[model samples]
Target: MAGLAIPTWDPETALLIGTILLEAIVLYVGYGGLERIVGPRLLKLVVGGE
Candidate 1:
């Protein structure tokens, strides 16, 4: 099962993983920023103020 075996030193695999990780981090930071900007107002509206 050559295809099933993972390479011990694979640059392509590393790059692919890195890309996915970077995207996840970017998304996380963006969502955190959005929450910081909108969360308080949304919470207040939902809970009927203060």
Candidate 2:
């Protein structure tokens, strides 16, 4: 099937895949940073404590 065909190396395909990977990495890091900044406070609120 065409959908199951092995990918051919192409600059455009490489760039598109690289961009998606980069975006995923960036989102992961950003969310991790935000969690580090706010996670404790959020947890405290949820658990109802000081």
Each prediction's RMSD over C-alphas, in Å, is 3.0, 2.6
Clashes of each: 0, 0
Candidate 1: where are CA atoms >4 Å away?
A: 1-7
lDDT of 1 by residue, 2-35 (tens): 6897569689989999999999999999999999
Cα RMSD, model 1? 3.0
Cα-based lDDT at residue 20, candidate 2: 100
lDDT of 2 at 30: 100
Q: Please provide, for model 2 over 1-50, each residue's C-alpha lDDT reduced to its tens digit, 9 standing for 90 to 100.
A: 46898768999989999999999999999999999999999999999988
What are the clashing pairs of model 1?
none
